[model samples]
Target: MNAGRPELSGTFGAVSSTHWLSSAAAMSVLERGGNAFDAAAAAGFVLQVVEPHFNGLGGDVPIVSYSAATQSVQVVCGQGPMPQAATIERFRSLGLEHIPGSGLLPAVVPGAFGAWMRMLAEHGTLPLADVLDHAIGYAENGFPLLAGAADAIEVLAPLFETEWTESGRVYLPDGRPPKAGALFRTPALATTYKRLLREAATAGGGREAQIAAAERAFYQGFVAEAIDSFVSSTAVLDATGRHHKGLLTGQDMADWRATVESPSSLSYRGLTVHKPGPWSQSPVFLQQLALLEGFDLHGMGLDSAEYIHTVTECAKLAFADREAWYGDPDHSDVPLDVLLSPAYTAARRALVEDKAAEVLRPGSPEGRTPFIPEQSAVDWPVADGSWMSQLANGLPTVVKATAARNDTCTIVVADRFGNLVAAVPSGGWLKSSPVVPGLGLSLGTRGQTMTLQEGHANSVGPGRRPRTTLSPSLVTKDGKPFMAFGTPGGDRQDQWTLGFFLAAVDFGLGLQAATETLAFHTDHFSASFTPHESRPKVLAVERNCDPEVIEELRSRGHDVEPAAEYSLGKVCAVAVDEKAGLLRAAASPRGRQTYAACR
Candidate 1:
């Protein structure tokens, strides 16, 4: 059995995140008397500096927060929408069937900055400078380069030297990839933040005004101008083996802002789970829970083949629904209420059997016909100028097929005030696009996840949000904050987090043990990212599972592949133990970089 890290418990505050530096930054904010929202924003910005390979300022974030003051949960939708100029006809005119995974062509209105500022302005008490201090410090002064970041830089060095020179300027300062563990700094990013602070100071009011000013500085001022100039003037090579200009403009950025909305919630085993709506793949997690609520998961045993098979099958069904029904509700009519209804869930649960199902089946929610995009058999384009090989992120090394290269980062925080927040910041990887010349950040390629096929729920359209895979979760028990948690695996976010939630709630495991438990996920449905590969009936299990169970699953018709032990997920979670007046936190040991802190 894998040994679990001790759960962190305290009366003050707790934080868990995918990077040690980000966790520390949040803990520092809490120690300074900042609330959970303040701490989360601090950690979010620090992650932008430290985990540039996974996320950046130009990325998107979906935050689910529970405020103790209001006793309510809200989703801060940081997911940016497609540029107004982006349309199916335009892509078709270019003879493109899908949005390119990496380049200016797939750029969206960068939404992370606006989202963080909005949350801070409304829910937090700290000044804008106070929250941004740690990030600017890390970017200006040096932090030890993470090994994964080093490797990503190394792989992309050739591409940087030849084509994306702006990225080369920031990442390959000495004309080479920096060695792992070496102190690294991005002075330009620090300058950008400092300039934003100066702009915020000009607002001449309190904390909220400053935050609002910072948001404007990013969306309408210098940052947006730099992005617009770069994208309008420069054509870059993408997955399509050619150079193309993006559709995003300064007006697109100016016109967009993050909005707060009610989360899609479900009740299971006395706990209420809240997730971002269909615009993200988050509701699928709740759907998986609703299906599993019918089964006796504890009786099946955590490592037993029955447990793994049942969970994987339910995940397949839930994700199939996600592919067929999920989209930006403003642009598409999604029958989410019917999909999550008890009758529909019961009918879908009946489809799970002893033998693994090989076909993708989306239920007709409300008797409405579901649209499943025709499976395209063409492989991702390969050419001398193509950079897809180096762009893949967060996939286990054991997997053979190419998938979404845009990985992500997570931060979950719980303060003594009973406030809780979970945020998944993703996209705009350093390798995804060329950095803006002055801004030191790349525009996110989130637009790549939107399909070009018309009449589909996630089809590309003007101002429509992509159905993203960045999902953060919040759970409340008895109308009080229970836990805030998330992980960073495109497509597998729901699968991995569902396992963690089950191990803790159903098996009565501590948070650390729950996170350490062996996890499994099926790639049976279409992926949400670019290349959008589907692996029917393939179940990827961590090697920590008993080998006997693996054979049992194989005999039951699962095409089992063993992933490296502790490689399936990197979950970061913080829980509030109201009965004991204690806050708890745990970070998975999978990545060796995640950390949790309490008190």
Candidate 2:
């Protein structure tokens, strides 16, 4: 396959992102002598502005980065916990079997701002104002509106006018959705950033103190106060088909702070792949790698029926385990050690037969019984508008005929000093929840990913982080930074990125070629989003896939569904050539918005 765009390479730095403006902003930071962390922080803020339909300041992000100065890879956990008042009993009392997908009830403590600030203060060379300047400018002045954002506004216009008035004020200026490619501005969002910057400047000391002050302002100061007042006082309509006030308060925001922790890692084909803990669905990628390692992926050939079946089966098994065992380790007893052990993979690998399996089978790790939450078919009122599109469609920005919402984005950057960062910024879409009054962002509906069932690893609880779908990937060759890569596909994130990795490592394809390779995923397990739907024995392959391969998969008991060409994944990646002293980057051409820059 010919990659529409070339794989970018340079010795100075390289940046890849789902949007051109974000990639350009990060690259500009690199040109200004900022490190990978600095560039990534700049890009994160810019993504919140430019891709409002995909992510926002009130969302969450999980970052995986390798710092040259520390010579270690670490995870910045930006996913916030449920409010102190949130509880499974509380939800059950509301006659809800599952967390509502949208509205204030599912809102968690907004975590993106704190996580970005933490990264900048700890690992970046630039100050808070410099890092946030690009986003502030884009939001204050005008930028071309994206077709997806316009579509989102159009879908939610009725709701905005009737219920989410705060959103109405921002997206439906003049009482209508903006046209695609028209100049659109979010002055309120720009004002929010400006206020934060002004507060940061009031701190007594240098760069670090200012960054700390900004973080405090967001979590403990005006931002928190506004969110508290809005959530506590407003009786808003949600997916439950009823009006309710949220449980989150100003204290919830104050109690939570983004934390830095060691990433879980596993070795595969001479590369050490690192991902966040079980709280995220990331380890499923490594688990798939472990199962696939037992097969001769090279012999099957890329995009072959044999290749697709094997990989799809492996993904089903891994994701089944994600539903059974993955959660916040701080809140539950997750046997991650046993789940990723070679013995576990060896046992689970046997479940992958020549044909597709129709049942959701999760293995018992350490002889402990697996608990699968009862799947419910909740007709979540995700109006036929932006909310439905964001949760039901496969990707955040693109229209796809899939059931899962991949409502997030990827950011990868590598600097000349061997520092690398990969982060997935997600949640708080313009349609997910009502925009907080006085703030230009919506609260994250991440709590919707948590189940209401008890005894499940990912059951909702006070102060517990939901088992999230957001995942960022980092890889090291010989214990040194090698590649940072990921995508924005709710449940399909690991599946899409896994295919790219196999194409690159097993088939010897370049970054761009590997990214543009045919994409596919199985809806064989429960989705992380609301309604928790699943389709056993189904495989969705891109239309670009060979017809013979599609038939071959169907013959093997797979209910194959064909998707639009270049619609499955929006992957972005950055790599370092240690021996050659070069940095490489690639962005998928799937959505026509993703871009890569290096020089």
Candidate 3:
């Protein structure tokens, strides 16, 4: 089955991590005759106000942009380096316990600012302040409470019980979380936005000016002083004798920038696929895709026994590589040249055993590098819901806790100028960071992904970035723009993305249909070398997948579990058919206020 270039459906397109404000900001940009880059920036800014847990201004951002004129796609690593003061010795000497979330210690340089500024500076035609007016207005004046935001705040009120340690203000007013549709205001946040606008206007009035304004305001001016004061008061670094370089410095703020890296590629199923350099999880994803492609995925059929088995086994194989060596490549050596080789992918995929548990780690081309990061052990036991019935028990089971949290938001935009942009901002979990008052903006606390232990691949170190999972991709097939997409849920991000790509291309679903389907992923790689993987083989799926499918998987000895709907992954995407000029978009329905639109 071949689909021709999609027809032009009147032209504007966008998708976001959540459904609520994504469409709002995208439409605003479209109405202004702005390009995809502008629309994406607008949407990302709007998201900072709409969904804080899933994203905020404090987190890091990475993007992949495509231009029809150039017929080329570029990737941006919107990750900030570890503070200069960060070191392995500091972590060990603390002797207090796990890296404390007390304040700036867990800080990573904020990248969303640099990404947005870069997009506007390089591709956007409109003024940065003009593009941000809508979001700034919304933040200052406040927007209606999204049912998702309200409900999430209610559930996580304990985190806001006290003022953010960095900024002495309560996250929730009067210790009460609001309900959906409530008028929530952030006067301090509004003030910050106004100051940024003022500085941008008074300065040279270019991308550099806008970025300078943000850095000075957030990292060195008012925001920096607040954070530095709080950290000093807390004595967080007393044991370590230093603080992260950019934590409260004019230099780090002035130097804040998103790195534009050279493109990297991997072969999957005879397709030459490229991903951003090591800043994101694109490497791990390429590994999984290559391993799965060797199995004839389209032939396995949707949710068929072979399909599930093949994908799961491939995940196990690929994840081994991920857990062992995947992290920010700038500070650590990743066997990328070896790992993505055709021979390596082929060997990893060949480990699938038909009609057998395949319970042992595959032996071949295994990583000899000795920097495997160790975590807690996993216990995978086989018990029966039906005393060895044909189907796995399918009972509700708690997914194991990883240091993971789903706090990223994404936006995809396409403009009439033939410019496409996909932006992913991670680290809205708000650990050790504070929200800018008037801006209603929160910075990223991304440094949390680092291990407190030394010599580990992800160990904390100055100028070294943490292993990031946010991968905003812009890809084409046979010389035409086809897809722009990303998701929340760290570690499993690319795994979830693989499902989305398969549904759209192999299953012939539209943007919405592809997004509505069931999804699943594995923690097998994150938990390496476990004696047994009692972890469920059948990932969380929609009830519609047919009970018989579960029965068959259980019959085959998979630990099947019924997961809360959409609990497995959060995904969003936007794609266009260049020949037809038709635009399409979708957001994860399983997520709160996750909405999308095309105009």
lDDT over C-alpha atoms for residue 568 of model 1? 76
What's model 1's TM-score? 0.97
- For candidate 1, write residues 149-185 as lDDT tens digits: 8877887788788888999999997798999999999
Off by over 4 Å in 2: 1-3, 379-406
Q: Which stretches of candidate 1 lie over 4 Å from their true place?
A: 378-381, 384-388, 391-406
In order of appearance, the predictions have TM-scores of 0.97, 0.97, 0.84
RMSD from true fold, candidate 1? 2.0
Query: What tens-digit string does per-residue lDDT give for candidate 3 at 128-196?
Result: 776778767877787886665565556435434443432325347655777678877655665666777
lDDT of 2: 0.88
What lDDT tens digits, residue by residue, belong to model 2 across residues 234-344?
Answer: 998776667889999999999999999999999999999999999999999989999999999999998999999999999999999998899999989999889889898
Pairs that clash in candidate 1: none
The best candidate by lDDT is 2
* Local error of candidate 3 at residue 209 (angstroms): 4.4
List the candidate 3 regions with Cα displacement exceeding 4 Å. Answer: 1-8, 12-17, 100-103, 155-170, 205-222, 235-251, 267-272, 355-367, 376-407, 430-443, 527-538
